[model samples]
Target: MRNGFAKTDDLIKMFNVSPGTITNMIKQLKTEGLVIHQPYKDVKLTEKGREIAIQAVRRRRIVE
Candidate 1:
């Protein structure tokens, strides 16, 4: 994202998913050490997460 961080509400709206889904997803990411979430704030990707994201985007472009 342009801001490099995503709030829970934004994630829910962007993914068209429920709040519970975002909460669970965030929890998983946190457990995996892929994201840093601040209570009542936004979630920022860790370096490892950013690398994975870049790889995914590159793979998508190549596949497409």
Candidate 2:
């Protein structure tokens, strides 16, 4: 989330992943300083996260 927060439930619904899977992925991202997660709250992306996301999107577009 760059401009807004994203809840795990919302991410699960969107990605069709299990809660535990999402939780672990979030934890990893947090460890990388890409995201910040709080208990029972939405996740927020850091500036580094946004930059990485944007780069990923660009790479995807190029591959496509």
Candidate 3:
């Protein structure tokens, strides 16, 4: 969801991944209804996606 909803170019650059990879992931997430994309707009996470991201953030913090 974040990939589609946020500025993903930076992350792509950081990860050195191709745009196709990012697009595929985003498409998969959307297909799962974890994300919603508005035409010509940043991707937005569904409620489910937000919940998942929040939990992920917490896990990362704890790990750190």
Best by lDDT: 1
For residues 24-48, write the lDDT of model 1, one tens digit per residue: 9999999999999977889999999
Instruction: Provide the global lDDT of candidate 1 against the true structure.
Output: 0.92
Q: Where does candidate 2 have its weakest 10-residue lDDT segment? A: 1-10
lDDT of 2 by residue, 1-64 (tens): 3356998899999899999999999999999999989978899889999899999999999999
Candidate 3 stretches with Cα past 4 Å from truth are: 1-11, 38-40
Residue pairs with colliding backbones in model 3 are 5-43
lDDT of 1 at 26: 92
Prediction-by-prediction clash tally? 0, 0, 1
Alpha-carbon TM-score of each model against the true structure: 0.91, 0.91, 0.71
In model 2, the clashing pairs are: none
What lDDT does each candidate get? 0.92, 0.91, 0.76
Local error of candidate 2 at residue 5 (angstroms): 1.0
- Model 1: weakest 10-residue lDDT segment is 1-10
- Residue 18 displacement in candidate 1 (angstroms): 0.2
